[model samples]
Target chain A: MSESFQRSAGRKVMSRSSAKELGAVSHLLVDAQQRQIAAVVIGRGKKAQLVEWAQLSGFGPDAVMVVDEGALQPPADDRERAAAEGRLELVGKRALSERGNELGKLDDVTFDADTGALEDLLIGDRRVHAGSLLGSGSYAAVLDESQEPSP
Target chain B: MRLLMTASQIRGLPVVTVQGGEDVAEVRDVIYSPEAGRLVGVTLNKRGFLAGRSREVLPAEAIHAVGQHAVMVLDESSLAAPEDAPDDVAHPAMERNVLGDDVLTEGGASLGKVADLVLLVGSSGEVVGYQIDKAGGGRGYIPLPAQLSVSGVALVVPNITEEFVQDDLVGLGAAVDEFRARLGLP
Candidate 1:
């Protein structure tokens, strides 16, 4: 099932080694091309760390399970990646069809927290599968014309 | 089954306790959990306009019903201060206000500031579209998508959103329906 990025934020990140809650999830670093979470960014700014998706065990309703807190590293190349990719962050971008139809702006994304796979786009206040994505960048997320909304 | 309600519609509804029918607070903000795919709780407002913020959050589990006139509560005591224990940190600051956030294109075209959030109501609540209050004296709704981004300054939308402006709320609602219809979902 898909869940919102908003809901996923603030869930505790639990370290199995100490069985202690390390910190809360702050935001996610989603790979736009890979369409999966690249890393989990947790805690406050500057002191924030990145737990690569591979190191995560599971996300319970209460906590995000990780085998080792060491798996989390200070975020590296986030700015480089953003700069290189033109920063294709998905939560607030406008969506359009290449054929010239104005669809809507993206409000939120629903992804499987377990698999880190993006599932649906809550675009234009509606639910469209990720399959509708044609192309995306920092400025706009183009969609398949068939996915365009109309009366 | 799906339920239809807007943030504006529920914003001021009275929240009363089920046991004695005592009024506690008014609905300030609806808190939704995407993980649970449901409306989890509401943030309450103090009785008067100039009152201070109440940290008390009403869990959706304690919500008796969301009625037309008022929001019924199971227990007023169930409305407790949000758990601020270090481990269970659900930050109050994490709550987003899309309203007034700038709407721009990847190409850097300014559409407008967000006037409202169009919520897609289900077992889980969704922020589906951003009702853009255009700078050019028009209005529109930008559908939410999987591939969007937010930041401290502005809400980045797909390019060329200004072209989709509708004149009024009714037009925006119709546009939202069209958006849903295209997706073949309820």
Candidate 2:
């Protein structure tokens, strides 16, 4: 089943071993080219933590299950740190076409619940396929304008 | 539709890095090469509180894309010190500015005074037209015609240019292709 980013926000993250809540879901960090969720950020700012998709034991509707509290890690690099800080969050970013025209603001993202593969980006009421994602930054998310390819 | 903007509008826009999504700097001035009809580089200002002119410059080649909201770069390292910048960028302060020069046709008819340059977005800073304060009335945009000469006093364009003056950037965008086709410019 596909899970919307809106539905996942604030979901509790629990440790499988102790079954204690580690943190709440902040947002998912995307690997644009791969069209997959790289990691899930929990909390925010300097105190933010991350759990790589590979480390997650299960992604349930109720809460995310990790192997243990040890699965949670501090941001590993500058890019990850920005993601953890919410500066690089995919939703709410202005979407610009590769040709530099503003499409709209991204409203939500849909991904596969089982594999964490990104499926689509919702820009207002428009659904953009995951394959069109080019790059994203603090200012805007760049997307391939799939409709009209310049000759 | 192609988005068009004046060079002056690009000033004060932030320069954001793609990987870390951090605003590294803001544009101070656009270093344009009117003779070449393209952007050469941009001087920068430091971002955030107490911000001021930055010593670093971003050469056009370092830019990933110039969008309406921000100028995108690969990373902060894409910026370079003035000494390491391209010749046009390093000494841009003294360059001859095109604004305020008279716009004249080859037939010697005075059209207007140059006001600004209109650039086509996403073509890597290609200058496509000129914004002018028309002699008899309001502002107008003209597709960049083949320049016969560019002197301190006047810019001489093809006589046929008078027929292509557009009312706005949107109109100028559509006129550019037709004007280029008429002039046999590739």
Candidate 3:
């Protein structure tokens, strides 16, 4: 397994060609062994674009480098279109209750810094505790104001 | 360890109006996973809407404040509970939603349900590609578009008509044949 590509989560990728330009890297494509970054998908512009690691010209504590638009691709594909569509669908999903009440749409999903697994789903106003429920056998419990101690 | 509150605790609280005394909704469900342990989604039960009808899932950032009584929302328009919400809210279309349902043409013709979704999984297992399931039953994958809304249930594709599926979807993923036959459909 390649080890050089192993990267810390939330690492910022800087543009080598453009010194000041930078993009937030949401995920990195590494080998199966979970090491060696084969490619990187930077979340920039209005979408997440895939760029080859070779295009990376530099790295830093706060950012990484790329060959200026060398890794860019024209946005036109049905599958890509559908995939983008799925992302939009996530915005309107109804946050419901066991009794089924309207809360809000999901805002973002946070992951563990080490394992890269799902951590918690951020809801509109409150954060639902989902740690126990995910993975192999754990289940989640629901809490409300009545359950919380008076702050 | 400092007493940390669980995401469930935050989800269950009733949502009262930030402006006054009106109770807007009750916390019905909290959607989260253990991997990240981060609260991602919330289900709210609107008081007036019928059972199962009033639920809405909002992003965690949309929350302006998490008070004792109610959790304030950033965008009120997002709170509107529509009877017919897109797939993302209803059910996760996953791989199954696309495989054979019939990809409609711009003019409204049968194309094919997604046979498989070719997702671009980074070294971190973060999904990057979202290949659509095509007819003729081949492993034709496509990159997932950036604009897509990946939320609770369905993959939301705007401008797409409704007359697509007969039943609601459960999850979305690549085609069954694409996998090595051991992992099965996720």
Candidate 4:
């Protein structure tokens, strides 16, 4: 979410303090509520690491800025790891309204590169804004008709 | 709308060679490393009339694109016997398939049954959440590393996790994000 990093995946990561190279960005952990990049999951399997956006000092064109190499921690915990699997899981899922209505296949979603805010969701033909983002669970992206995002 | 394919939806998907479109193989299993949180590789069943054991494998990198009906690859180069596959392509030791296993609260309250493993989009080798059948008679998902302990039989999660159960995919997806934030799962 730091000033909207457009392309996050595969970016090199360096610690400002130690001037040490950590690793490249493997995945962006987005916070749904905040609608921004919460952290970046780096490394692989057992060595996988996570660096929260707050720990980042800056977002450069060449590398992602971080405080120190120590900020990187293995994303070994079950919860954090679980979130990674679900992050990009939304696209193939279905979109449903509160009335149990079948909307359609969630086609795509746009996220702001500058603010890291999720902009809108393309569900089949209709577009749903982030404000309409009710839940992005394993089953579907549910919307609340009672609270529609203004055009 | 970023199209997402479920494990079940992608199974049986033909692995077609991009060059010739030759049906090199059919995807039989999608292997994911929960620890890595991305898809590691896949197992294939030879195109035969009979149901047989899994053999051929292609690491995630060999994939070109997973379409609505088929999984396309750059070429047949990725097709290799499981034994010859790179270390990352070899199926990890899955002494158990946690698919149908029951999930429980740390103290033994029933949470749900493991329905499916959710693979995030754009994640080449990571797994994100487990779609569970809640004891309340519906489905919900708990983000990975939800501070669960494996008891050889069931997954026991913290009691507070009950609040995170979601009925739909997007909600479940959001729950995982929120849950990770609460637990500070980094």
Best by DockQ: 2
Please report how far candidate 4 places residue B76 from its true position, in Å: 2.3
- TM-score-superior candidate, 1 or 3: 1
Instruction: Tell me candidate 1's interface RMSD.
Output: 20.4
lDDT of 2 at B115: 94
Name the 10 consecutive residues with the lowest summed lDDT in model 3 chain A: A133-142
lDDT, candidates in the order shown: 0.62, 0.83, 0.38, 0.63
Q: Give the residue spans of candidate 4 off by over 4 A.
A: A1-151, B1-5, B16-23, B32-39, B46-54, B61-72, B86-94, B106-108, B146-151, B158-160
- Tens-place lDDT per residue, model 3, B1-186, is 011222334555654432222245656654332122222334677654454435565444444444423454422444534244433434433443323434444454533454432221111112222334444544333323233443332344322322222111111233222331332323
Worst 10 residues of 4 chain B by lDDT: B119-128
lDDT of 2 by residue, B12-70 (tens): 98887655445789999888777777788888999889599898999988887776667
For model 1, how does the per-residue alpha-carbon lDDT over A47-116 read when each residue is reduced to its tens digit?
7677888898886677888888788777577442442232445667666553333467788878897798
CA-RMSD of model 1? 21.6
Global local distance difference test of model 3: 0.38
Please say which candidate is ahead in DockQ: 1 or 2: 2
lDDT of 1 by residue, B119-139 (tens): 543212355566677767676
Off by over 4 Å in 3: A1-151, B1-3, B7-12, B19-21, B33-36, B48-55, B78-186
TM-scores of the models, in the order given: 0.40, 0.90, 0.24, 0.45
Off by over 4 Å in 2: A147-151, B18-21, B93-95, B146-148
